[model samples]
Target: MTEESPGAPGGGRPEDVRHRLVEVFGERVSASVPLAGLTTFRTGGAADWLLETSDPADIVAAVRVTRALDLPLTVFGGGSNVLVGDGGVRGLVVRVRHGAISAHGTSTVRADGGVTLNGLVRWAIQRGMAGLERWAGTPGTVGGAIYGNAHFDGLMVGDMVAEVGLVDRTGSILRVSGSEMAFGYDESRVQHTGEFVLWANFDVAAGDPAKLRAAARESLGFRKRTQPLAQASAGCVFQNPRVTDDSLSGGVPRTAGALIDGAGLKGCRVGGAVVSTIHGNFIVSDGAATSADVRTLIEHCRSAVVDRFGVLLREELVYVGVFG
Candidate 1:
């Protein structure tokens, strides 16, 4: 749909979009807001219109309001796994912040979409819950995790999901079974349907809180030792390649980082963006990087890998808005 009014001159005025959003969100809606602070990358321009809310009802209402105005909508969770454009985004950008969580009976846990994955892991552990403790240092909110079927150590968040409450593009809410999500490696039904996750139910098992906490600490320590958590990056830049030819690897591990490292692309730089030496799969910013710089660097790495090995890498990172 177009964010333009046929009746207005010069497509629609920005004020018109803001006015309609203000009607629905009052002072919660803003204009020309900087977006870099919301993402893990800490790069990007601003949103022409922005809405921050902690209510699931507000998300549904925002959908209706934006639809009525014929404007586009972009939902942001904890702002990990995304690269917003330097030119900024048009229309309304909604940031979900509702993070209420609860436990039902013995083994079921319900959490709002805005709850951080790490937070959920902690909450589950404190209650002697077993399943989520392994995802201790995972970034992003529950909604974002569900959207991408966030995985770690061969286990996907989708695997533990029992059901999810979703708000579709037309502002309709529905509960769907986990199987209906069509979750695969870095994929989900929400990516195709443009649906928003309101909350989710995870089927977990009761376990020892001490054991769960220890597992969580181990996970965190592993991340710190291997990944570039000290740098400004969007986690892993590329997804691990699926090995097709056993001879192609030559001896290196069948992983994205190993492929990049084998290709001798570590520490490769473009502008202020550099491939992290600690982890070949990560592209880090030196606090002076632009979105354009990072995008260019990513392309360079991909091209290098393609040249060295016939494998074409896939990115796990999501790009938002327009790139210039």
Candidate 2:
């Protein structure tokens, strides 16, 4: 291991701490790793320390060491809904790679936090499960989906979540039940609490194998038809504003996408970032889009909607690093 630099924390300098982490993680640890490769936007700079942990024990150790050294720690899952800054992260970046999925019972499934949403969907479909069919086309890991409380057709991932295993700030693991999670529309108590999800269990219903497969295919097809799946985006940029109870009597609730499209903000661009013409809610990064570009487009879209419809839009994706 490299020797500690002068005047650093935990009896070592940042470089020494990084070296120690690399020694512990072995091949999983990388120095000055490219953030572009770690996120969906594919446009940010490198991170000072990027540690990939395939074991839950390693994850706990990484967190403990970073906290002990007073280094900032950021957890990365599938990286589908994040925009890393060009300046890169100045702390420890822990990427979960311990993806595994297992059938707990005829109506239950257990998945590691690193398991991709698509992977979980496929696993469930193969077992004739029905509840997760709606999320067939969503990107990112199961943990990210749960953290963001992702939803479609008024159904949310949290609704199926039966239990979640979390790592607290002090490196203690806690298992929380569904009712204890306190989920809201596109939001969860996990965010405010700063808990790191290690794994989750989902409750699902049994269905015909052929029918479940068809549902998965149809759901994915609908997503491809309506969303810019080929482009670089963090899914929906804004949460849909709530409709009055009276509005529910006539039709479905009003969505931010519909509102933005109605306000004529489709194809809107700020630098290389553009509101996807295919899906007004998605802001796509066209090769060279920066975090600033994405932010500018988000603000512009919100401003346009507010000016035209008198509704203030809320963000769906959580901005991290410098942007946050």
Candidate 1's C-alpha runs over 4 A off are: 1-11, 244-253
List candidate 2 segments past 4 Å from native: 1-12, 244-253
| TM, every model | 0.94, 0.90
TM match of model 2 to true structure: 0.90
Give per-residue lDDT, candidate 2, residue 261. 90
Write one digit per residue (lDDT tens) for candidate 1, span 261-285: 9899899888889999999999999
lDDT of 2 by residue, 51-139 (tens): 77656666678777777777777887878888787666666788875477888878889999888888888888888888888788888
**Each candidate: what lDDT?**
0.86, 0.80
What does the lDDT come to for candidate 1?
Answer: 0.86
lDDT top scorer: 1
What's the lDDT of the predicted structure labeled candidate 2?
A: 0.80
